[model samples]
Target: MEPKNNEEEWGKTAWEFLTQVRTQSPLIQCITNFVSMDLMANTLLSAGASPAMLHSLPEIPHFTPRADALLINLGTLSPSWLPSFNSAAELCHSLGTPWVLDPVAVSASPFRFNACLELLRFKPAVIRGNASEIIALSMPQHSTTDSTKGADSTHESTDAVEAAKLLAQRTGAIVAVTGATDIVTDGNQVVGARNGVALMQKITATGCSVTALIAAFVAVDKSHALDATVSALAVFGVAGELGMKEAKGPASLRMHLIDALYGLDEAALKSHVNITSLC
Candidate 1:
């Protein structure tokens, strides 16, 4: 395999991906939790993509097929919602539309754990989650007895690199574990991005919002999924970094982050993107 070690080469494409989203205005259908609707929609809108917060089974036949990409976030997972998630995944897989999975607190319960594994069979274009979520998700066969603290990560992002790689291999999807330094991998290759400010972590649904960002990025370039996933993280980080410059706290950071994302120019993307090959 060719080496992806050149940092500048990896970093430059961030603008291309951002530009494509602005030009294409891909429609991203998000089947996310209640808490994330507002932030996630704003995140996609700021990145110049349309966000559709639709998750009803009735609309799957008509709506999901037409979406440029789909995002299935298992944040507020329940038995009633499983059918909708499954129907959308099956539709997206059949149509070859890039879809992303955000398995929030995936191992928090046995029910949610099994649901994630079932969705993996549909082959999402990307799977984005935190270290604890990735680590728990990587073990597909193990029982859902793993004690993962709900929503928050007990482990650092670096600690889940191996697990992320293994999950990518198993699922045939780009695996991204977000933390201080976001990690992206496609089983054989790994990329790292360091740009977001620390304060962004304190905000609610930031992870969920970034997952939608990943979906939007991949939606624009379904063929180059690895690059798209990395670009999304780096771009989001750059926005957080810029937003932090004027942010007073997580609340202000959240607001400024959307503003930064909406206003990102090529210069900002070029100067702030920090993606590099980890291997």
Candidate 2:
């Protein structure tokens, strides 16, 4: 399938998902690191999705299948979190609930690097990362540098497209590479969502929060994971673009971004969105 066809199909499906979010608020179980907790939870709420931070082994197993989606972020990996992560992933798989993965700093530590590979065994529905993280996740040998020390990407979004495609092919997951311009793929197709501000990188926790948002969309609309990922990216990026214009800096921009997301509608998307379809 070509990128244009994928974009067209995803576009319609995304709108369907937006309607679903408005009607049925899905509960999202997030076993993410502590760094992104506030931004992620608030973003999910603004987008009409419920979010819970459930990381304990006992709690995660009980909640994983009941929630609409399970989102795991390996930002601050600890040995204690491993059992919970694995058990929740297994429950999601057994219950047929979709899940999203964010390999935050897989390149830095041997523990996180191997842990990410282990997470792949669960077959994530969507994978979200920046350039280096995506590159490292796809081919660890080629990208030895870690991207978790800072939220900013050292590589352009375009540079990671191939890596995203490769990872998607290997895992059968929708891959989202976010940078100056976000590129999302499912091995055979690509959709570029070009509507964010450079200020997005300056803000802390944006990428991790975006990952959680993607999971929320995917949980509500599992039939089209690519569309769910793209919609989440596009909507969040568009909000950033709009929010930066009126805000003073990263601090104010973060608050305004949430307002912008809550303010987003079909009218705003039709005029403000700048995504291009390319295969």
Candidate 3:
């Protein structure tokens, strides 16, 4: 998954998107898992975006309208919380505020999996998840065999490329499968972000944090969902690659990663970003 000769072009494009995010400082409404709330908010702030972890259903009318973008993550799905998510997403649809969906561990159960499918009705701007989750989401709605997995993906990110494409085609959303090589697709063009350190996987909520970051990126762009999604992932990966240099372990890497994202300059981004077209 080495970048082609056009790496510089993609790097600059990504940097341009990040610049837009900083300029806009889009207020992102995130209805995410409790465990990820802190890290996700920190990730958005480090990237120069405002994050609002508002989930109360009553606030949807006022906040959702003002938010530049929204993130609905099923990482901590509950029967009680699904309606608020539905309400928020529906409002985002009506207001045309781009929203992202992170269907964490969709195969773990029936209720959580069905909740993810239901959210697809509004047609999210982007869908980010692991390979197994992507594979599960792309499966026939009636299938029963693709069950029993935890949040962790059983397969490699590359294994779900076809599924990711299929999902994007069916749902009309840019689908991103995150793993060693983060894959982004729009049912046509498939892009792979070859950045980040393997140690990133050890940190809890990194995936959730990245999804929120994607929400921030698309909040600023809104038109080029695929490019925005790729850029967010690549930028996060570049931050991870840089943070790994001074990190003693997963704990320190977490702090350093946020700092790297906060301090990323044109030079480091242009030199380190490795996004490429995937066959």
All candidates' lDDT scores?
Answer: 0.91, 0.83, 0.92
- Model 1 agreement with the true structure over 133-209: per-residue lDDT tens digits: 99999985545566678898988999999999999999999999999999999998888899898888899999999
**Whole-model lDDT, candidate 3?**
0.92
Which 10 consecutive residues of model 1 have the lowest summed lDDT? 1-10
* Residue 180 displacement in candidate 2 (angstroms): 0.8
Please provide, for model 2 over 123-237, each residue's C-alpha lDDT reduced to its tens digit, 9 standing for 90 to 100.
9999999887898889845344445454446678899989999999999999999888889999988888887898887777899999988998898779778878888887788
Clashing pairs in 1: none
Worst 10 residues of 3 by lDDT: 140-149
CA deviation > 4 Å runs, candidate 2:
1-13, 140-151
TM-score of each: 0.97, 0.93, 0.96
Model 3: per-residue Cα lDDT over 1-279, one tens digit each: 233347888898789989998998999999999999999999999999999999998888888999999999998888989988899988888888899999998888878879998899988999999999999999867346764366888889999999999999999999999999999999988999999999999999999999999999999888989889999999999999999999999999999999999999999999998888876
**True-structure RMSD for candidate 3:** 2.3
Model 1 stretches astray by more than 4 angstroms: 1-4, 142-145
